[model samples]
Target: MTLDVALSHRFKDFALDVAFEAPAGVTVLFGRSGSGKTTVANALAGLLRPQSGRASINGTVLFDTAAGVWLPPHLRRVGYVFQEGRLFPHLTVRRNLLYGRWFARGAADGASFERVVRLLGLEHLLARRPGALSGGEKQRVALGRALLSRPQLLLMDEPLAALDEARKAEILPYLERIRDQTEVPILYVSHSVAEVARLATTVVALDRGRVVRAGPAAAVLSDPEAVPTLGVREAGAMLVGRVVRHHPDGLTEVALSAGPIFMPRLEVEPGVSLRIRIEAKDVIVARGRPEGLSALNILPAEVATVRRGAGGGVIVQFRAGQDLLLARVTRRSADALELIPGAACHLVMKSVAVAQADIGEVAQAD
Candidate 1:
């Protein structure tokens, strides 16, 4: 299903105007707080009506201001997952999950009760109540609850915002499984680049109250010009790799477009595929492979674009193998190297630069 949104809503202090189309995949509504992301989510959920334009899913009109069409929240059939796991405190896991299907009107969804239980690893917790579950388990239950509703689209408004790093780590793999296995497309809202890097197939970036950039996740996240919206320190490139082997030296090898990358050992078994982020600031560019360097990884790269940002700094985009890589250097460095589009260079990155938090399990949309 394609979610087409052209909405305009106004508060006393802020006005929102945006338009975008999200196809049958995970399309992330990404931006900072109060950047109209929640407004878009609310509009799609039928909780907020816009003053102009309309919204629809796969040609099914949910709201059209001019035509006086407005579907109530219940009638919209969109499942929403909030920051907190709003599971019923009084019910067991099985009962709480069944409550979700009670409102489902059509055929079973991409997320059925049995499938969700398996996908979320809730088999052992069926008899347990919410209070007995851990934070990560609760969020997974909440996600399952939303999915079991059989909605056409899922709205996750910073679903991991309330969880700490450890809880986030425990739950992210399940999200990856959901994105890859489910037929239902998700409309996820998040500000964390790590989450976006991990789960989003498409990224719809918002700034202030307007749509800034919207396109495939690979292209948008790798674009040098997107640094302003992505935040300078957070801007990075995403690379997909397959776990080839684990070495005895406490390093796991991943095969990517740029040969292989060796990093700290990963707990996942071999052959598991994953995506990782390389922050722009952590990369160094060299004209040739350096003689002696502490960084063990170096990939052949070609310049794609050079974006000069504030504070005399420059963001250089390069095509490293089939994937993209980014480096943040000063204008002086770029000038000295005579960097321009299509210029060949080498990308130097330390194995440790790829943080544990920066790596995410692959979620290939069907």
Candidate 2:
């Protein structure tokens, strides 16, 4: 699946004009609230008519104002998953999922009912109604329903926003299963950087309704220059490594471009390659090898770029082998520490600062 979008729409206080394309994987619409992530998604869903532009999936035009082509939402064969579960109040979970099957339109290659039910862990709640299911369960059912509809494209508008942290965690891996195991190209709208990092194959970043950046998720998220607005502190980097071993002290060691890093134990086994995300804000740069620091991971890095921001702050980019790291500090700190481009520094980071959202199996979609 491929998505090509060039859209322009006007509101009372803001005008949205943006264009980008996504391939056969999850393409994330990332920005703060009211930045038009949802607006673009709606336009793609055929729910909102753009003043003038073309939107298409794999050469089939979904909307074209100039050509007077507009496909109804149902005919487009796109599945929608909203923030809330939107499950039928009076129907059982099985019934709701079966409801999506009616839209197959002879394309019965629809995701298997039993396969989807197991993938989403919806077996236990099959007999329950939407009102009786937990937040996470309902969302799982929502996902199952969408998959059963045999959609060529899936649109998710902050599908995890209404849930709490624990609930969000619950559904994220199932989404990963959807992305990796299924071929549906998903257009996902989100404001959470962590969510995008873990789930997106391609990222389309928006700022005030304009596209600030659009590229591979790892490439765009790892750029040192994007830290401040991206909400990275001491700004670390993303590293691809494999689990080497687990120790009795509740630590897991993984090899990186620089060296091996140890963190709280993970469930993964040796030889299983993993992507780990480290925050720049969580890193402490040292002028020399410190003797007694409690930090476990230290790597030599050369300062790449130093840019100044408002409020007497500086953003420094670092290159540690293949990994890109970022650090933000007071202008005074940079001067006193003698930090500059090409200077050698030790990046000291604690592994515990990494959250589950920062890491996942690196997606292979282009």
Candidate 3:
């Protein structure tokens, strides 16, 4: 399913005018606070009617101001997951999930319930109440409930925003499962670059009520021109690698298109595909392959693009094998190294540079 949205709304001081098309899979609406991310989600969910706009899923128009069509919130098959789980405090997990069936309009079947429970790993928590669940567990329950609703689209508005790091870590895998396993398209709103890197198949980056960038996750994240919008500290590239083997010295080896890269040991077995985020600031560029460097990962690359930042740094993109990697270097260094598109170079990165939190399992099709 593809989500097409064109919305215009005016608040007392803020005017939101944005439009974008999101393809199937997890399409993340990313930006800083007050960028109209939630506003778009609300518009699509029928929670808020924009002064003038149009929204549709695969040509099924939910609202079209020009045509005088407006579907009420209940009529729009959108399942919304908020920042908090917002599950009923008194209801058992089973009941909370079943509550969604009430809105399914008899479209959901017994197999749907079983599928959702298993997809979210909720079987063990069925009889427990929300009061007894951890924050991650609660969110998983909430996701199961949403899935059980049998919505055509899912809107997640910073579903991990309320959780601490530990809880966020715990729920991320389950989100990955939903993205890969279900046919439901998702419009996820988040300010987190880590979440975008890990989960997004397509990224629509908004800035102050307008779309600044929109494309596949890899292209958008690897673009140096998006640095200012993505936040300098958060800008990075996503690399997909397959686990080759675990070494005896407590390191895991993964095969990237650029060749073999080593990182801190991962718990997954060999041959499992993983998505790894490589922060631009953590990379170093060399004119040639250095022989004495301690970095475990060094790949031959060619400069893809070079963009100078407002400050003293330059964001350089490199085509490392089939993937693009980024590096932030000083303006002087970039000039001294003659970093330009098509220029030959090498990317140097240490094994420990990849954080455990930045590593995620690649969603697989069943």
Candidate 4:
């Protein structure tokens, strides 16, 4: 296994008993505010020792309480990025980045100084202090510093939660580059469904310190039962598609398993395969194919299941070829349209509604 984790910890009213295995790519710990996502991450990084359990990555044991084996944070060779940049205000950006080199273990820092600077687009700000850069830029510097240490695994805890929308947008692409280009695996933590859908190869869902679900991003995100827990508005399906063509009218054609889907123009070049997260609320269900609709996407699908919301709505699951899509509607609409399991229906989606933040690599959203 690329990563193995199984532990039990207790603190006041909360008890965390979670077990999961995440491969070499990005694995996310996703859930609500107090779900122990951060706790799991900290434990893995050796920042928080678990009462009893074992954690190993690529055959190296980081911790084993029963066996009395525990590696210190520095020896664990794990890099951490916190919610805030936490860069040294007194040090120049270049020096801040170089500081990480001191803790680098046996390996020649896997990434070079110039390469790290270029990867994060931090060359221009190299002479400045932490106080001089924007929130996004500061985070980028923090990330560069962490990367310079040449860690075997990376742990990021809500790195974008403190940024505004525009700042968040600015830092996303750099993260995507890190996810795609680097060999190091990432163990990220976040509560946002949109974040999980875009960045995670595998998702471990937690609730009040307990792991509720764990699987590939596409499978876990499309599950109707997992939607409510993730958040009704954030619940959705993730589809992996490639950019076939770009239209002059601000739209990009994505060839998916079901059919060609057209969405707002993306910044990626043709032939780039990207993951798009379609929110359940944004999807509409029609008993039959509708004509003259403003929505550009209308794919034929068969109803797979119908679920009731905690309030007063119905959540419908549709199978579009190999991909699954979801639509949220009122109970009255289901009855009026006679929507049932295995019923043929058309799923309509609007192009403009798809958030750019929800597209591209997993790290972009997380």
* Residue 244 lDDT (model 3): 100
Arrange candidates by TM-score, descending: 3, 1, 4, 2
Task: Give the TM-score of each candidate.
Answer: 0.96, 0.94, 0.97, 0.95
Kindly list the per-residue Cα lDDT of model 2 for residues 1-366, writing each as its tens digit.
Answer: 889999899989999999999987899998878888999989988889888889999999999888999999888988999999999999999999999887876895667899899888888888999999889888999999999999989999999999999999889889988988888889999988778867888889888889988887777777756665456442445667778999999999988887888888888777777767777677788878777978888888888888787778787778887777777778898998888899999888887878776767654432
Q: How high is the lDDT of residue 162 in model 1?
A: 94
Identify the leading candidate in terms of TM-score. Answer: 3
lDDT of 1 at 239: 88
Q: Which ten residues in a row have the lowest lDDT in candidate 4?
A: 357-366
Q: Provide the global lDDT of candidate 4 against the true structure.
A: 0.87
lDDT, candidate 3, 186-240, per-residue tens = 9999999999989999999999899999999989999988888999998899999
Which residue pairs come into collision in candidate 3?
none
lDDT of 4 at 224: 82
Which residue ranges in model 3 land beyond 4 Å of their true spot?
Answer: 108-111, 364-366
Give the deviation of candidate 4 from the true structure as CA RMSD: 2.2
Which residue pairs clash in candidate 4?
Answer: 198-362, 199-362
